[model samples]
Target: MEGMNGRSVRGVEGYTRWSLISLAVGEPVLLWLLLHTLHDGGSALAGPGVAVLAVLVLAHTAACIHAMIAALRRVDPDRGRRGLLPLAATTAAVLVAVVVVLPLDGPAEPVLASIPRASAVAVIGLATIGALSARWPMRILAALTVVVLALVTLTQLGSRIGGIIYLLPAYALVLVSMIASFRLTVWLLEVVRELEVSRESHASLAVAEERLRIARDIHDVVGRGLSVVAVKSELAATLASRGDERAEREMREVRQVAQDSLEQVRTLVSGYRATDLGTELAGARAVLDATGIRVTVTGSADGASPAAQDALGAVVREAVTNVVRHARATWCTLELGAPGGRGAPGVEDGEWCLVVANDGSRGDGAGPGTGVDAVVPGNGLRGLAERLTPLGGTLTTTRSDGVFTLTASVPSRETA
Candidate 1:
């Protein structure tokens, strides 16, 4: 346990120092270490052999100290910590080199203090770079290690082959391991990023789908109930002048319908849906009539496909919604027709078409529907378009002075 604890602490300290060194000066120390390992000890670990090892180790130790200082400054560039790291690293490196290079002082045994110290420092530097950089750079370092070994094995006239024999293979092995580890890390990062993007896209699509669902529900519930209420109220008003008991009953029915409408509206707003074509048409007419606007709905087939009906339904709803909100007109018309030879502009569709038009708003400046704002289809129009697309259909809306129009066209299954 004690041994493990000691190793853990050493590893941590080594990592911290190593990071500092690389930040201070890119790869100089590592380079020097490689150089010395290649050139040092010409089969004799004494004299010049010792000197070479001593210089390499000492230089690395210095680099490590310098790196620590640089890292600290990088983390916090201002204040008193500025020059301290550089100074400390330089002092440490020099002192360490001297201790390692020189033999033990006095009449005892030969001791180079920096041997252990240099090893510790180099380890720290190596670890820090590995920790800080992504895997690609590490792998490159690893693969190039082969080249470095090849360089070592080559003789330069006076250079001896003894040192390269052992150290070259060791360095090559370390390089291979490091490169593989880094490559794995890089692969992992890419995977994580892709996952994150996919998750975000899914979340966005879900939100959009939810909003579409809510809008459809609202159109079904509130739209239908409101239509019924309008019809009953109109019937009651007409009967009021005739002195009929049925008129009073119609008024009560209107009130009941209004209440039902409110409840349905609330339910739809809360994400409930129960849709029917009749209700939607009725709702559209009622809404238009409430504004004293004439409303007309015409379609040839109740036998229309599910897709066609939905497309038609969306057009009517959007037309009503716009006329009620923006057109401010006293008259609106809905026209549905079968697929014909003449294709509608803006829609590449080749099928039946749904057209809803209202007397244009009389407002000064411009009509309620034109330009970019014309495409300013309320959520209903946009949703209709999407729903129609699955049915291989299209919806087109247009507005002229005091006239608002919506067209929903579905390509027949053959064209689709």
Candidate 2:
């Protein structure tokens, strides 16, 4: 699941980056072609001048695209500014490209013909670079619009007023759209990265909370008892040094206090090892639901003894963990009760049963005589079997038709 999510994030980032690059390159090419067709009824491919200008425009746009991608990679808002040198070089290259075309000894119509292509390339490059560098999209759009408009107007100074009017709005629209697209893409990537970070942080916090809970429980169990033992042992030593007859009795009481504290600690550890069936079921449901798996729980733990419940709860915990981590199952059913009609031949009456079943089994560990132990050996199903065997419980697993089921049964009449 983690790998799948990571791939999804990287896929989105790659797609967005290339999509922006494609737009940066394609828009100017298409615009130049269209303008060339409209202004002169000749093929855009017919002129050497057109080819040279196309190469220059493509080179400049490629530089801008590279800079934009680099900027996007450094999405952390807290980091120092980056890609500035690339942005500056690309912007300088755009000016150089425009100036190289300015001195062509041609008719005003030819000079004017080249203006829109240069303007389009400049607007796209500047808008993309500004989108990455500027903190605010609107500011970048406004500034890009002014810069592109002035460049176009100066280049077309002796040309038609109508051409300036036509080019200005076109450039403004391109600037607005490019800025908005780049900003939105960057924002989306940032959000995805933050979600991944948040998930990791959430897991860390859960582990920390569990540690704190254990620490608190340990303190409650041993803190006062150990303090009492320390005080009594000191008193006993003092009495013995003064040749008091109560010294032996004081020492015995100190030993008893220490033994009692040890017993209490053992009970605390036992409680940690035992899991509540009801709590485990609820937790399993919540966890599976969060992962988009449907969980159906039936019957109740009320009929089972504490030991039977603990064993079955452990079974549930292991089964649910496997389903989440390996099975890729879409639905799971947890049923706990007497075996009833589902019992095997040797199973007697009055026995509690836990049946955990799910679809989408991977089949690697679901063969005859195999179990989750085959998938995750040593401490998985083998451990569960070891745990249940002491209580006369049996663990069995089977897989068929893309479903895996684990059944555990124990005598509910047995005392804890």
Candidate 3:
């Protein structure tokens, strides 16, 4: 699952280390080659050395093939390890070292012959089939260490330091550790890259899930209340137009309906509000009409995607909210106007905009104000600004004559 440095462990990094072991073991191949070369005692690269070079290069060739397969298995989160061909080529050159630095012990005799001839074929077979293992480090270390130690211990002919039999094992161990460390480091980088990708993916998923949850809650609170308020308000308006005194009684009931809805909306605003333009308009009209404030609205987009419509609706809702709650208005006009209609000159005609204006009454404390009671920064207004900002829109508020006005300019999707 994880490594000492908080890095995820990759099973195939073991194969990469094995390739390095193959490279380090090249020195011994060269030594064996030189010993195998030469006719009698004189120096010559012709004759048997030609054949020795092939065998020396062959082991490195095998290592190259191993590296290639290891490279292909790599999965990258940052940098891809797609081709093992280069690693294979690097390992292959180790065989050439066998040809160059090898001591001429005269004729290729029983040098590498001691290796288990049966397993040699098996190792070659495994490499060709793209087989790999976890115990690869232990296997390579033990096998190569034995071979290198034997060569160093028994063969101290005419060097400055003559006998150093015990030192071979230590040097072999150190060599293996260094090569393994380099490979382990590379693998670690790869693993880290993958983890960072995973973290980003998880974070993005969390944000999307949160948005969906908020949407659901808003629908639950505002959806039912708005529907009921709409039906009752429509009845009140119909009755008032017909000059019926019974309309006044229903109007009282309308007031109760609106107040109950406002209470529920107030509770919701404390938690989260998914107030879009349509819902806010319905709620705003209900609230204002019940308070005897005449409401006028215009320029709303009739048919649009839910998201665009929702965002536009928030503009109206928040504007109407501030007007009803703070403007102390007797009459409020809600306008989802076109861009360039009056305030903005250059834009097109149908660039649907929002303008909510309310004419104030004398000390008209008839409605509850923005929730100063709970001391929470009300989402009713703040949420509106936050939503519109992302769409390159503008929301402005000002007061004129006894009326407070809030206008939101939402550019059409094409221009936006």
> Which candidate has the top score in lDDT?
2
Candidate 2 lDDT tens digits, 290-340:
555878998778756788888889899999999888777878999877645
Clashes of each: 16, 0, 10
- The segments of candidate 2 whose C-alpha lies over 4 angstroms from its true place after superposition are 1-66, 73-75, 78-80, 98-119, 126-137, 159-164, 188-203, 288-299, 322-338, 341-378, 389-416
TM-score of every candidate? 0.31, 0.71, 0.33
Query: Mind giving the per-residue lDDT tens digits that candidate 1 earns over 137-164?
Result: 4455455444444433432113333434
User: Model 1: how far is 74 from its true place, Å?
Assistant: 20
**Model 3, position 146: C-alpha lDDT score:** 58
| Residue 148 lDDT (model 1) | 43
Measured over all alpha carbons after superposition, the RMSD of each candidate to the real structure, in angstroms, is 23.0, 5.9, 21.1
lDDT of 3 by residue, 1-416 (tens): 22111112233455455554454355445444443443333445454545565554465455544544454344432122323444345334543443353442333233332221211222222232121221234475456545545544434334322224333444555555654665465566466546646655755886899899878877887787778778878888899899987788877887887788788778877545443556667767765664446777665555544445667776665666666566556578876654445543332465566776676623323334531121123566567777767765666555434455565655566333
The best candidate by TM-score is 2
RMSD of 2: 5.9
